[model samples]
Target: MKTKITNLQPGMIVGEDIYNLKNSLNLKKGQKLDRDMIDLILKSDITEIEIMDSNASIGFIQKTFEELPNIIDETIYNKWIDSISDLFHHFTKEEIYVSLNNITEEIYKSLNVKEYFVLNFINSFGNDSLTYHSLNTAIIVSIIAKKIEIPYIMYKQTVKFSLIHDIGYAMLDDRVINDFDSDDKNALIHNIVAYKKLQDLKATLNHEILESILYHHERYDGKGKFHLKGEKIPPLVRITQVADAYTSLTELGYTPYQALSWILKKCGFIFDPYYVGLLYEITGYYPTGTKVKLSDGSIGIVLRRNEIEFFPEVLVNNEPVKTGPDSNVYIKEVIE
Candidate 1:
């Protein structure tokens, strides 16, 4: 069956090879379409393509899922939290690397259904423990990394670095760690301390990972701890900086919408505008798990982002409602 590009969905299978106007093959036959692939198709001049019939496409996706191994669940999520908490207590370089490696592998596996992963992560926010913050930052990095198609090895390195990005805080005094004033001299050294603490693991960890951890505080406009500015900072560090700040803000009681809004407001001055754009791409204007009220007086939780930025797919009264230009329903305001 031939379907217009606008009608394509994530689970549809290509029924034949698709060629561009220049007669170059774009999508191969039998390819199972994903959101990215659909977006690619939409961007190209191709307006229609042959896809498997609806019934067959549904069956194909169902069979593919049934054959695949189970991904993350609530039990595994708790275990990950416990493992991260344990890492803080044990505080060994070798153990930290091993645990983060395992956790990164599991996170990559869950990327196949990243929407669910993002939803689970947003809903899992808890008390402001170093453990929770570390894991939260890692999850956010994983989602961003996967969306941008960062290489597999580099993705693992970035996620691992995020998991231990603030390991230095564990070595600080209780007051310094708990209070956490950026302006305070004692609190500012945590980045340097973390860098030094990981020196012994240089043989095991990638150099980029270590460098990123050290410079994660570098602002895009040279106002950070070190005053390093703009392109002088490593790209990986810039990306991690945005994720770290957003996680910290949310931990400090900012709502998802508020945290993202703050980041957007600081773009170019505090964070790399390109990376900030990517964060918005992943989180949408109203990120997943945000409580909101609709124009029709119905309350709902944002389930996932849609092509439309302001109106996301929301779960209202046990049903998913996709709000967009064609729909009368829309999000009116975020609930506090």
Candidate 2:
């Protein structure tokens, strides 16, 4: 039966896969409807959906909403990672662009009004492989794009650029690619190589996108590989640089809070202060998911940031505790 969202009720089963306006999957077929799921549907543009007949639950054991994971669809996410890995192994400009577009669409669906939860979920995990790193950086770039309120078209282009910004790394020797401190000359030329590889597709790609990938290695203080300093670097490229660095640092075992703190210390020396400020604004003083010790000698995970500067809601003993002027407890130190 086709039913309007207002008609949805608990225990109702989805008759077909439901997607959002961008064609990203929202709910899977056969999922038993719950209050939270109904609310999610209501929040989206989807007005009506197919629901299973009332007799469909012959042997069904409905799962509670709490049992469902609120993260991105794992199947889609893993497929995207594999798609990126395949692109690295076999380079095709057209196919790569299509894949990126699809991935961005899914990202939009995942982040819809769930920015804080989604961002915290992403920051809580880390992977050192190039494929995962590329995807992670792209997601971070998307978050920053949302924070800055860039035009939708430009946001898409920026995210696509980030998805393959390190394609040149795939061309390097395995040993060099794996060694973070590699002194080999090939390590220094990955950006140039990536630029040249994409240079042929200029008709399909804009100059800013290509240049952003090319000069991503350039530092703000005129000390990078090409020494292109300050405003000489493209604005989008500056954003990418910050995202790339933060992702890389976290992959190297730095917590999100630690990575942001490291980036803050660099300021204008290694990064543009303006862009760095934007990064801080989105992630807050202590990013969500960071484990910290409180003034009362209890450990808690940051739940979310509040209006207060340094205080965020924390989850301790399975209960939320707000830390700020009103609460006696406050975060004392990060748990590394």
Clashes of each: 0, 0
Please, what are the lDDT tens digits per residue for candidate 2 over residues 46-121? 8899988757533221111222232455566677777787778766455566666788777765664334542432
TM-score of 1: 0.71
Quote the RMSD, in angstroms, for model 2.
16.9
Q: What is the lDDT of candidate 2?
A: 0.68
Instruction: Tell me how far the alpha carbon of residue 217 in candidate 1 is from the true structure, in angstroms, after superposition.
Output: 0.7
Each model's lDDT comes to 0.69, 0.68
What TM-score does prediction 2 earn?
0.71
Across 173-267, the per-residue lDDT of candidate 1 in tens digits comes to 22122222245454577778867877887877668878877887787888877789999988777777778877765543455676788788889
User: What are the runs in model 1 whose C-alpha is more than 4 Å off?
Assistant: 1-72, 93-96, 113-128, 173-181
Candidate 1 backbone collisions, by pair: none
